[model samples]
Target: MDYWKSKVLPKMRLIFVKAGGKKAAAAAELVKSFDESKGEINSEFEEKKADLQPKVVEIYESVTAPVKVLIKERKKVSAIKKNSAAITKLFEDLANIEFPGAKQVSEGISKVGPALLSSPIFATFEKIAKLLPVVVEETPKEAPAATEEKKDEAAAAEEKKEEAADEEKKEEAVEDKKEEAPAAAEEAAPAATAAAEPAAEETSAAPAPEAEPEAAAPAEAESAPATAEETPKAA
Candidate 1:
């Protein structure tokens, strides 16, 4: 029996036993805490379980109860408040009081529901109105007056635009005149010089052909004297 137990049993135990690991000590501690042989569970783990159970039960009850019915009732009350005429009438009937009408204002609210719902300002006001039982007044809003000052401002803007256009046109005309002035001066210069040439020639004296013949006769007289003097010497 010793030979079988020492040789076969130890080998059999090695075969059955899981491979020991880095986590074996932690796993053994966990096993010891759970084992009835060690006694009841650790006090800290039991206390944590007790703390979590009530929260778990609360969550379970909330998920299982009539959540849909509560949501539906809240929506119906909201709708009743939205239809203010109906609520007003309900209040009037129940309390048996003769108050001012709320039907027209209620109709206005209904007609402008989409506008009111889209506006944060109107939506917040509407929520406040729903909470309170005050009657909504439909006071008429006056159209803004067309003051003389506003009309004058519009006319002034138009006049300023016209003045700007006129100034632009005047600037263009001045530029065109500046460009044309040089061209006009170039064309007039030759005509002015040609006209001056004729005037200068007419005013100045040009020697006549008759005056040249007269001047040559005087030279003829002076040479005769010299000729006479030479002849005497030759004789």
Candidate 2:
């Protein structure tokens, strides 16, 4: 029983795992619904595309086709037209044209678009022409670079100013030290001389005081003998 439970239970658990989890069941339901919706939408889109594809492909093919090079190309420039409804009419008119040569067809389309659209067509074409190069490869302006250079120059000028200020402070400190040196030396010299004078006077008088003490003691002894003689005469 123990072996059966241990082995069979594990095998049953593995089977349950193979059946997948609750989250997986929910995800599968969601995917099934999404796939059905996607299939329906795709079929509808394909049917629509089937109707539009031929016309769009024709336009694409005509645009891609090579044109015969003219020996002397016409330097023809169209006048600017300013109209909104005219531009839409021009696109419609160009769509109807089927030209003999590819170059002629392209030229016909360009001319027809400008003529029908008028000013709006010209403005849109100009805008697209300006945008195409910018969209593909951006051209950076030099203003930021010029500003960065100015900032660097300003920083350098400020650093030079700070260095000059530091140099002036150092010069002032040096001058102050120089001015204090003479006063310090003069003040120290008087103190030293005054201390030396006292030492010299004490040394010179020290020997004189010791010699005078011996002379003074004999004078006191002679006076004592005279005083003894005067006492005997009085008795």
Candidate 3:
């Protein structure tokens, strides 16, 4: 594990190298034992890692994205110290994932994890990385806050589109009414002129007063003509 490598192993090297006689012999024996067991350790580590990869990837995907942000901003002191409940959950989950000699590594974290700020976070990840497929940098998924902002923007744009569409409809209606006003007046003008033409034609085509007297005389003459004609008709 990374903790073993970074902390315990160095101390081991220092102590073994510093001492002489029995200590040097014991260190040699220990190295031989590790070498003999290396094959088994590696095989077990690999198997456990394969099993844990699924859960690790799941955690990486589901951890509220703060974990990724923390890892991405690990270099910054402020960012590194950002305490995320998701990261705490990550530590808890990592503690549960077993590997070859996993206890030896997580022992430090279990003791110091709750009170610790940042280093153990990285250290926990480092161990997980060795034992699981941790995708520290995949795609940066948007947080709920960011997702809501996007939704708001989309809704605003949709509202604007609806407003624009409504305005266009109103303008079209106004334009249609304007056009109809002129068309209706044009229709009415012809109808009014046609009605007036018949009246004017009747007035202008009326019989004259002179013609009326002549038409009356013929009727009167016909009525008197029978008496004068009767005298001559008797012979």
TM-score of 3: 0.30
Residue-level lDDT of model 3, residues 1-235, one tens digit each, is 9999999999998877676455445444544544566567567766677677777666666666656665544554354336544555665665566545334334433433323334434544554555434456435565766889999999999999999999999999999999999999999999999999999999999986667777999899998988888989898
Model 3 ranges off by over 4 Å: 1-37, 40-142, 198-235
Overall local distance difference test of candidate 3: 0.62
Model 2 scores a C-alpha lDDT of: 0.49
* lDDT of candidate 1 over 135-196, digit per residue (tens): 45553342233466688899999999999999999999999999999999999999999999
Where does candidate 1 stray beyond 4 Å? 1-127, 130-143, 146-150, 200-205, 208-235
On a 0 to 1 TM-score scale, where does candidate 1 land against the true structure? 0.30
TM-score of each model, paired residue for residue: 0.30, 0.31, 0.30
RMSD of each: 25.8, 23.0, 15.4
Could you tally the backbone clashes for each prediction?
A: 0, 6, 0
